[model samples]
Target chain A: MLKIDCKDKHFSEIGKTIRESKDKEIVIDNCLGHRYIASGVGGKDIVINGTPGNALGSYLDGCKIVVNGSAQDAVGDTMNDGIIIIHGNSGDATGYAMRGGKIFIKGDAGYRAGIHMKAYKDKFPVLVIGGKAGSFLGEYQAGGIILVLGVNTDSKTNVGYFTGNGMHGGKIILRSDELPDLPPQIISRKANAEDLQEIEKYVQEYCSYFGGEPKDIMEKSFYVLTADSANPYKQLYTSL
Target chain B: MAINYIYPVYEVVRNASRCVNCKICEKQCANGVHKFDAKNGIMIADESKCVNCHRCVATCPTRALKIVKSDNTYRENANWSAESMKEIYKQAESGGVLLSSMGNPQPLPVYWDKIVINAAQVTNPSVDPLREPMETTVFLGSKPDEIVRDKDGKIVDNMTSQLKLSTPIMFSAMSYGSISYNAHASLAKAAEKLGIFYNTGEGGLHEDFYRYGKNTIVQVASGRFGVYKDYLEAGACIEIKVGQGAKPGIGGHLPGTKIVGDISKTRMIPVGSDAISPAPHHDIYSIEDLRQLVYSLKEATGYKKPIAVKVGAVHNVSAVASGIARSGADIIVIDGFRGGTGATPTRIRDNVGIPIELALASVDKRLRDEGIRGNVSLVVGGSIRNSADVIKAIALGADACYIATAALMAMGCHLCRSCHLGKCNWGIATQVPELVQRLDPEEGCDRLVNLVNAWTHEIKEMMGGMGINSIEALKGNRLMLRGVGLNEKELEILGIKHAGE
Candidate 1:
């Protein structure tokens, strides 16, 4: 793999170097606060060692990104197709507007994860967060699948407040009791046998990436949140 | 229904002698304004459904059809006009905020008409553009605040990236979802042919138009729809849409009805889903935050494409512009209230932002005062009407101008102002397969090219009349402009003298 030390380089310079490289697989080391790494880049397997900044793997198309450490906000934003494996926690708006991708985060995530995730044609994005998730999870999501495992959290709640607010499509699988006091527009349900089957492949992939027993994880009570189609936010616009 | 409360605003008059019994008008109207009367063996009209798009009038074979605004009148109460009463009645009928397409039509002072162009006299001989070379070419992007040189004492060309336009006018951002694929294709093809650029609004670039990358400016808005790495790299320049002029603070809303087929793929959203963009980029809470997003785009594009920060002409727009100038934006596009849109709430569209003339003047002056004018090129647009308006805008310190409604008109739009209904009989805005097919991209492109080509030549003529062959000399040449029917306050804001002075 072609390796580069992005310790003190500006993000643009580093990005330029990465784009100019003909190597199919690349490794970036010592990534600090430099943001927008691998933005709109595709067709490569990028491995990052240190903590990458915000918008990591943003707009990443048809690539594989392996982040060894925690990442900041907007990971895999509007990503079309890719596999981003993050071993550590992530910041807010993770997987924002993601359309097609598999974002496997081992640790907890900040607010607004999978916000506006959608799918069209054969493209469906699947985001799996290992630990607990913050509030407004999957807000305004139109399609795709989001799974928050809530693995090893000391907190009482698995997912935070206002989860699935303005959510129109897609399914959010939370590994806990159904969230309470959400917008009346959401339809949260206990994942039954058929529901588990629907998410079986995604669960298998997440378990493989983050080291978990599939049966043990699936055994836990899971809840799915989908927007109520009958009330598709007519109030969003002013009435008269 | 109870009182025949509303009357049709327009009436179609057809002459029997000149009119052939052809069903072309019935076939052309998407609004169902014309129908063939089977028993009578003649064409009948449903004037209430007519939007006055003139499609039927234009399609009449023998020039037999004509449309006129009906003398439809309410009681002569200046306070409650006909349109206002109709609007209230419509709202009462259907409890929905009235949505309008195109620019504000509230008789808000059109500064373009108020401003007058100055011509050269005996002292400065005017050149004939027909025979003489009048340079209309311009480059829109950040220039170095100060040129730096090495010990060799040679000046360095360290300017940021710039978009070189053969003409100073470019087709503004009109997304794929808002306009038809044919409209976008026409614009792209025309931009390519004209050596200018067309914007792929907030809607993502259609995959077919990727070949026009050299002439496309892809836009990233709060929704971040269709923004991918490839999209970021697809355009010659990237525009970050902070605010749109038509709905200043509000975000774009493409009703789910219009989101179908390739539009779904282009925008990466589901079919028949409302694509509502947030008003603000959640990541950018401040100018410092704006800087991060700006630099992020630059990084994503390898600092190759110029980054433009587009904002509406709000009260403190110039202040915001100064912040954008410092935020590493290569270009700042200030859109005034009169800017067009696919759909916007009528209230907001009519009354929200400042005029383009004042905003452009203020931004230009502010940038020049801060000595950061060279740091970003200023492109102003909102109802840029003709060559005179363009010349006026350039004199007020705009590097270039953007025109949308004019381009739409050239593409067979009749400005029926009912684009929100998506039944564009002229086939400019609607997405219905039949209506879309009506606008053949090949024909549309030629018309657009002809329009811009005509405008470019006219701009040259105006520049020649001013005894200024090069557009660069006319940059911020406010002395070449004079106000006619404007107040002192307007004159001060425009930074120009009275017509006689």
Candidate 2:
């Protein structure tokens, strides 16, 4: 394991050091506001301390990024394959357009979490927010699994307003009985045994990283939000 | 019968004298407009189904068919024209947004027509392009503001990654879902042969065209479709599509129906999922945000390829372009309102953005004033009609001009404006296997090569007439341009004098 101090280092310098280093397991300390950390990088275990900036692990391909502190906007953006575990809260667009990856957040996430997240073939992205998610959560989500546990929230609804607007695919499972005001296209129902079974591994994985019992978290009634058809806006156009 | 039946816009004219009853027109039309009446021993026409793509006219062995605008009347009113009435009827019946293909069809002012090029007369003799060597090759990327020297005082290579084009022309972005596979193949082959680039748009690169990576500009839009490390590394340059001119400030939704097989595979989506490229990149909101994306892409690609930011020529396009120039982008592509699209809302397409001509001139002047012009190369597109337009664009401060509509025309598109329906008989914009096979890639490539070569020759001729030997010398040389029928404000904005000034 290589321990690197990023006290006065630029983002590029830190990135260059990581790319050039032969060490498989590396740790970055004082990683404040350094964007694009481990972007498109693979085959490494990167652990960052301090508040990392936006786009952490963007286009991350087959790497594991563990952020000890909070992560800013656009965490795991367009990430093809990887695992990004954030111990603290996350900013906006936690998993923007990510095709394949697993992003587990211990605390709440900001707006547009898991927006436009898609799935292809065997690759499916899973974003689990232990705490509540901000407004416009899972907007335009094509495919993938987004689970908002609302770990410490007092309110019944974990997600904010306009949830699943323009969503065409995927499932948004919230551990709450009362549902948020979802968009017209989205259909909401209680998570069946099969649905819960499918996300059991992810829930267990999230609990492993964030420190919680999967059974305790799964005790509540989870509401699943999904769109029926893949093409929600199919009838919105008239050929001129 | 429905009371809101609008008359067909075009009428099929089949010449009885020239008719050979070959049934080629019926076989050629994908819209099913023509049919053979075996009992009548003749061909029947469905004018209502006609898009006037002229595919049948071109395919007819004996030149027996033609399409003409209908002479049908609905009382002449300039305010509420026949087109307006038909559009009203369409919306009233469907209760959906009227979607159209291709560019804006409105008879708005085309600045290129008003701008005229200058030529050397008595004072300076013009160089004959045939006798003298003329340079049309252009390199697009950021240039170092000043020369850097090593410790030994040796001049170091300060140049960034640059795309070398044999001519100042490139095939603009047109995705696989929007166009046909054969059309993409043709563009890729032609771009390879021409030493230019053809953009993959936002559909992502098809696996088959990976070999043409050197001549391709892979795009990343709001949706970030098909964008992985390999896709980014496959292209010569990566273009970030901020906005499109056809429907400025709006997102692109390649309908679920068009998402089939390869298109779905290329986009990395399901077989029938709507590929929604939202209006704004959810991650990008400000110039600072854009810089993050640019740097993120750079990091992903290891800073090897040049990154381009493309935006529609909206009212504040110059300001937007200036921001892009400072956003670590190596190239700024300004697409005008006349840019083509597979589908867009009719109202937004016609009424949203500004012209490329004015936008380019203003952006060039602004960047130069800020002394950051060398930070990024300017590539303008929207309606570069011919070689003349290309030359005019270079003189008006463009490193290169992107051509899509013209390239589509070279690939046999008749401008039928029915691409949204996916029934393009010319095979340029359809996905149906049979319809797509109509456009032979070899033939299409040959035609595109011929068109580009012809345009390059014309550009050289114009450059020779102007006593300019190299394309780089004409970059931002607005003194070589003069506005003929433009107002004072227009001339001022274009940074060109009126004719005979």
Best by lDDT: 2
- For residues A1-240, write the lDDT of model 2, one tens digit per residue: 988888998898888888788999999999889988998898999999998999999999999989999999999999999899999999999999999989999999999999999999988999999999999999999999999998888867988888998898998999987999877788999989998897677789888887879899888898999997787778888888
Instruction: TM-score each candidate.
Output: 0.95, 0.99
Indicate the worst ten consecutive residues by lDDT in candidate 2 chain A: A198-207
Instruction: For candidate 2, state the interface root-mean-square deviation in angstroms to 1 decimal.
Output: 0.8
- Say which candidate scores most in TM-score: 2
Chain A (alone) TM-scores for all candidate structures:
0.94, 0.97
Native contacts recovered by candidate 1, as a share?
A: 0.36
lDDT of 1: 0.87
How well does each candidate reproduce the native contacts, as fnat?
A: 0.36, 0.86
True contacts kept of 2: 0.86
**How would you encode candidate 2's per-residue C-alpha lDDT over B306-412 as one tens digit per residue?**
99999999999889888999999999999999999999999999999999999999999999999899999999999899999999999999999999999999998
Model 2 stretches with alpha carbons more than 4 Å out: none
